[model samples]
Target chain A: MQINLALAQIATKLGDVQSNLEKHLDLIEQAKARKADLLVFPELSLTGYVLQDLVATVAHKPTEDDPVFKHLLKASHDLDLVVGFVDEDSRHRFYIASAYLSGGRTLHVHHKVYLPTYGLFDEGRFFAWGDSVRSFDTRFGRVGMLICEDFWHASPPYLLWLDGADIMLFSSASPGRGLNDKEKLESARWVERVTKAYASMFTSFVAHSNRVGYEDGLLFWGGAVAYDPNGELIAQGPYFEEALTVASLDLNQLRRTRARLPLLRDERTNLVQKELDRILSK
Target chain B: MKIDLSINTNLARTILTAFIKSEITRADYSRAVINLSGGLDSALSLALTVEALGAENVLALRLPYRTSSPDSLEHAQLLVDQFKVRSETIDITPMVDPLFERDPQMSKTRKGNLMARARMIVLYDQSEVFKGLAVGTSNKTEILLGYSTQWGDSASAINPIGDLYKTQVRQLSQALGVPQPIIDKAPSADLWEGQTDEGELGFTYAEVDQLLYLLVDERYSPQECVEAGFDAKFVDVVVKRVRRSQFKRMQPPIAKLSNRTVGYDFLYLRDWGT
Candidate 1:
C-alpha cells in the first residue's frame, strides 16, 4: 500500500490563538488541495510556544463537546490530520499533546512525556508529564504519534516500536536563534538517522514536521522530512521558512528491507527485557 | 534631585548588603571592576560593586576619548574622591586612532564600539592583573534594544543590571548618591558629537523603559500595551527591537552529535549544578 503524506510549516504567533487557528484552517485547505491523504502540523499549532503563564488559561481539553475539537474534527473529515495542542487531563494539569484525526473524530491522542525546563524553555512549569505511549491502527499502517520533546527520549519511541507501530509521526516547534541554522539542520539529520535506523530494524517509516516563524524572540526553523523503511531520506523541506513537504511511501518496501536486513527477526527480546529490568531496578 | 520615597539609610544599607551577598553567591565571583563612564548607569554599577565586593576590591577604569566632555572625567574623579577606591584613566584616543587609520570607513558608531571594546580589553587585562571579574553596566533597556556593542560594552564576566530597566537604573543611581551632573545629563554613548541615546532610538528612555517594564517584566502583550494607553507605534517599535535583537540574548548555537550538546541537546546553564 502506498500512502501520501503532507507536512505543513505553519507561521504561528505567540499567545494569539485566533490568528493561529485561522492559519491552521488555511494550511489544511492547502494540504487538501495537494491531494495528501495525511497532513501533519507543528507542535502547539493552536497556541504558540513562550506563552508563559498564559498557557494555563489557553490550554484546551479536546472533548466531543469542545468547540476547538469539533472544528478540527470537521477539518479532518476529508483528510487524515495530525496537529499539536496544549491538552488538559482530569487532573487539570496540561500536557503538550498531539492528536490524530480521521473521519471527523480523534483516532488517537498522544501526550508529550518530556517537558523541557532549562534555558529558554519552561515547559515543566506549564505541562504535566504523560505516562502512556499511544499508537493506533490506520488504513496505511499502525501509526504512532509523538510531540516535540517526546522523540528526543529513547524510551518512548522504543516502546512505540515494541507496541507494533510501523510508522512514526513526530511534530515539533523547535526554537532557533543566531547561528542555529546549522544546528537545526544537524538535529533534523540526527533525528532522521536515529528514527530511520530504528525503522530499518523494525521495518517501518517515519514522517517529521516542524513549524516556522518568530515567536517571543525565538525563530522556529521548519525543515520537515521523511524516511523510508530502508533508512533513506525520501523527502525534506526548506530550512528557516514555511513549506509543505510531501512523500509517498510504499509499505511493500518495509517487507523487502526487513527480508534483506533480518535485524527484527534476529532480535532476542527475552535477553533485552532482562537487561531493561536490571537497569530499571537500579 | 526629588526623592520618590523617603530615604531610610539603615534600610538602604541592609538592602545593599543583601544585594551584594546574593550577587556574589550567584556568580561565584570575588573581585569586580566597573567601566566608570561618569554616567548614572556606571555610577550605580560602581556603588553596587563597592557595596557588593567592598571599595578596596572594586576597581574603577575611566576611559575618556579626546572628544569626551570634560565634565565626565570630573564626575568620575568625584566618585573616586568619595569612595577612596583604586582608579585609572586610559585615553582611548591612542587606541581608537590607530584602528580608524587602518579602516577609514569606520562610522562614528563603529568608532564608539571600538572605543568601548578597547576599554573592555584594557579592563579585562587589568582584571587578570587584579584577579577581578569585569562587571557590566548596561541596563535592561539598552540590552533589549541591542544598544551595547558585543564584546565591547556588552562583554562582562557577569552582569547585575541586565534585568533592571533604565528608569530603575536612574532610581538606583539616585539612591546610591551618584553625582547630579551625571544623572541630570541626557544618556549617550558619546560615540559622536551631539549624539544622545534618545535621539538615536527616536524615543525617550523613560517611555521605552516603561513599555519594556510592562512587556517583559509584567508580561503585557501588544494588545494589552495599547489597552494600557501606550502609543501603538511605541509598542510596535519596542516589540520590533526585542524581536530583531534576540541573537544578543542567546548563546551561539553549536552543532549536536553528542547526546547532550549546548543549545540543542543540552539545556542547562554551565553553572547550574544538575
Candidate 2:
C-alpha cells in the first residue's frame, strides 16, 4: 500500500485562536490539494504557543454535538486529520490533546502523558497527565498517536509498537530558543532512530510534526520529519520556519524490512515484564 | 504632614514569611542560593531567605564584574560579616569577555543581561552541586517596568522579592539590618561606564517606587494615578512596561485539552500535597 502524508508546519501566534483556526483550515485545503491521504498538524495548532492566562479565557469544550468538532469533521471527510487542541474534560481539568478526524466525525482524542514542568516548560502547571495510550485502525494500517513529551518516555511508544501499531504520529509545539531547536532536532532524531529501529525489527513508520514562530518570549522551531521502517529519513522540513512537507511510504517496503530483521520473533516479553515491574514497583 | 495609614509590621512579616514558605514547599526545595549584589533588593531577599530557612540553609554568592564599584563589594562584605554566614566571590568579567570579543556589537543592555545570566548560570550550577534552589532578587518595581532580562536576572527557581515594591524592599532591608551603604547607594546595573538605574529609567528609585506603590499595590487606574500626583507620562511608562512584559509572567501556551492550567488550570501550590 502506498500512503501520501502531509505535515503542516503552521506559524502560530500566541492567544490568536481564530486566526490560527483559519490558518489550519487553509492548510487542510492545501493538504487536500497536494492529494495527501493523511494530514498532521503541530501541537495546539488552534491557539498558538504561550497562551498564558488566555488559555483559561479561550479554551472551549468540544462535545459530540459541538459546531467546532462538526466543522472539522466536515473538512476532514475522506482524509485522516490529526490536529492538536486544549480540551476541557468533564472533570474541568484542561488537557493537551490531539483529535483524530475522519469519516466526517471525531474519532478519538489522545491526551499528553508527560507534563514537562521544568526550565521554560510548565505543562504540569497547566494540563493533567493522561493515563492511556490510544491506537486506531486506519485504511493504511494500525496507527498510534503521541504528543510532544509522550515520546520522551519509553513506555508509551514501546507499548504502542508492541500492540501492533504499524505507524506512529507525533505532534509537538516544542519551544525554539537558546539551544531548544538543537534539542528538538536531537529529540526528533532519537524518536526516529528508536521507533524506526523498533519498526525495522517489527516493521513500522513514524511521522513527527512541530510548530514554528515567536509566541510570547518563546520561539517554536518547525523541523517536521518522517522515517521509513528501516530508520531511513523519507522526508525532512526546515527549522525555525513553517512549511508543509509530504512523503510517500510503501507498506510492502515495511514488510520486506521486517522480513530481513526479525528481532521481534525472539520471545523475551516475560523477562522484559519482570524488569519493568521491578523498575515501576514502589 | 502625617497621613493616616495602617502599618502592620506583623502583617507584612506574615505576608513575606508565608510567600517564602509557600514557594519553597511548592518547588520541594530544601535550601536556597542567592546573589548578594549589595543592593537593597538582594539584601532584602537574602534576609528573607535567612529568616524563612535559617542561615545554615542559605548560601550567598557575591559576583562582581571587573568594573563593579568598590562600594558594592564593601557593602556585600558588610552583609556577610554581619550575618556570619558563608559567602563566595566569583568575578564574572573573565567569563563574559570572550563572548563580547566575539560579538563586539553587543549592546550595553545585552552585555548586562549576559552578565546577569552568567551569574545565574553559576548560581544554578552551585545550586545543583549544593542541592539548593536559586532565589530571585527582582523587586516588583523592576518587574513592572520590564527592567530585568528574561532567563537572565529574571530567571529563577523561585522569587521571594518579586512582588515587593522597591521602597518596600528598602524598608524591609533596613528592618533586617542590611548594611547602610547598600541601602544608601543609588541603584545601578553596573553594566558600563557612568550607568545608573535612574539614568536609564528616567526616574529616581524613590519616585518610581512611590508611583508603583500607588498604582500596582493599590490597584489604581491610570487616571487615578495622575490624580494621585504621579506624572501622567511616568504612569504611562510603567503601565506600558507592565503590559509589554506580561509574557514574562506566564508559561508558553500549550493548546488546551484539559480544563485546568496555571492560567487556565486551577491547580494551586497547596494542591501538590493532595
Candidate 3:
C-alpha cells in the first residue's frame, strides 16, 4: 500500500492547551492541503514538554467533548491523524499518550511505555507508565506506537514486530543538547542513525516526529524524519525550525525486506518471554 | 574528533537572537534588560536582545562606579543611542561607598565585589519595576576561568553570550556592529582607576580562547594541549582553573539526604507551563 505521510514539527506552549490547539489545527490544515495520507505530531503536541506541576493542569481525556478533541475529530474526517496528548484516565491517573484518529473517530490510544526520569527529563514524576505494547489496524496497514524515550529500548520494536506491525510511529520531544549539531546533540545525526537502524531491524516503516523551540533553557531541535522498511531515508526535516517532512511509504516493501533479512520469521518469542519473566521476577 | 571552532557569524547571530527571544517570551515576558558595561560581551548581548525583543522592549542599564573610566560611559552612551533602546545610567558609587567607608580594612578587591553586587541589585530591582528579565554579559572564557565576581555580574535571569568564547565574542561583536572603540580597547573590570583584565589575569583572551578550545572542546589532555603548542605550565594553569571553578558553573550541590533535594532531585525547570 502506497501512502503519503507528513511529520509535523511544531513548537508547543507549556500550559496553554487552547493556544496550542490553534497551532495544531493550522498544521493539520497545511498537511491536508499537501495531500498527506497521515500527519504525525510530536509527543505532547497539545501541551509542551517539561510540564513539572502543570501536567495535571493540562491533562485531559480524549473521551471528553473538549474543543481541541472536537476540532481534531472534525479534521480527522478527511485525513488520518496521529497526535500526542497528555491523557487523564477515568481514575484520574495521567499518562503520556498518543491518539490515532481515523475516519472521524478515536481508533487507538497508545500510552508511553517508558518514562524518562534522568538528566533533563522528569516524566516519571507526573505520568503513569503504560503496560502494553500492541499494534492496531489502520487504513495503510497495522501500525504500532512508541513515545519519545520508548524508542531507546530495543524490546518495544521487537515486541511491535511480533505483534505484526508494518509501521512504527514515534512521537518525540527530544532536546538538542550538545555542541555540534551533526554529532554531539541528542537531535543530531545519532537520532537519524538509530531511527534508520530500528526501521531495518523491525522491517517496518518508521516515522519519527520531533518538535523544535526553546523552553526555559532547553532547546528542542526539530529534526522530524521517516525511513523506508529497507532502512533508507525517505524524508528528513530541518534542524531548529518548524517544518513538515512528507514521505511516501510502500507497505509492500516491508514484506520484501522481511524476506531478505528473515529476522522476524526465525525469532524465538516464547523463549524470550520465558527468559524475561524469569529475569524480571527475580 | 576534529571540531570546527569557526561559527557562521550570520547563523550564530540568528540562532542566538531566536534563543533569547524564545527564552524571554516563553517565560511570559515581553522585555529584556541587560547591563551594558561598554564591553564586547555586554554590547553584543544588548544588540541581540534588541534584535530579539525589538529596541522598545530592551533596556540597557549603565551601572558605573566613581572610579570607572569616562571612556566607558561614552562608549555605553554611543551604543544606547545607536540601538535606540531604553537606557538608564545609575551611579553605584553612592550605594557601595558607605559600606567601604565603614571598614578601612576593606581592600580594593572587596570594594570591587561590593560594586559588582550593587550593580546586580539595581538590575534586579529594575527588573521588577520594568517587568523585564536580566540578560547576562559574561563570556565563556571568563565563566570557565572564574574571572567574574560571583552573584555579581554572574547573576542574570538569562545569558546569551555566556556560551561564546572571548574570541568568538569579539568576532560576533564586530558582526553585530558593536562600536569599534569598545571592540578595539583592552578589556578591563574598571574596579580601580586604571586596572585592565589582561594585566591582572596574566594572559590575553585570544591565547586563552585557543588553549580552552584545545583543552575543553577538543577534549585534549593537558599534555596533549602542551604538545599542540600550548605552554606546559600555561596548560596546567588553565586546566587547574577550569577544574577548581567547576562550582561556579553549577548550582550548589546539595547533600543527597532527602528524597528530593533542591539541586539533586528537585532539579526541575521553573516558570514551566505558566
**Local distance difference test, each candidate:** 0.76, 0.75, 0.85
What lDDT, from 0 to 1, does candidate 2 have?
0.75
Which parts of model 2 have CA positions greater than 4 angstroms off?
A60-64, A177-202, A278-282, B1-274
What is candidate 3's CA lDDT for residue A228?
Answer: 87
Off by over 4 Å in 1: A177-189, B1-274
Question: Each predicted complex: what DockQ?
Answer: 0.02, 0.02, 0.32
**Tens-digit lDDT track of model 2 for B18-44:** 456545654677688888877788888
* lDDT for residue B108 in candidate 2, whole number 0-100: 86
DockQ (model 1, Cα): 0.02
Give per-residue CA lDDT, model 2, range A4-117, as digits (tens).
Answer: 998998876556666677788888888888888999998888776555455665465544476456667778775888888888887788888888888776677888889888
Question: Compared with the true structure, what per-residue lDDT tens digits does model 1 show for residues A1-282?
Answer: 887899998767656666677887888888888888899999988887666556666677666677677777888877888878888887787888888888887888888888888766788876788889967888777899888788777777777877878788988888742221133334455665666676665667887888876542345668788888887888998876679898888888878888888766777778989998999999
lDDT of 3 by residue, A3-46 (tens): 89999999887778998889989998899888899999999999
lDDT of 1 by residue, B1-274 (tens): 1112222343333334444444454456678787888777888778878886789988899999989977778888889877778998889898889889998888887888888899889989888887778878888899998888878888877666665677767766777777777889998887677788999999998777777767875688998988888899889988998899888877787877888676764433322210
lDDT score of model 1? Answer: 0.76
Task: Locate the minimum summed-lDDT window of 10 residues in model 1 chain B.
Answer: B1-10
Model 2 docking tier (incorrect/acceptable/medium/high): incorrect
Superposed Cα deviation of residue A6, candidate 2 (Å)? 0.7
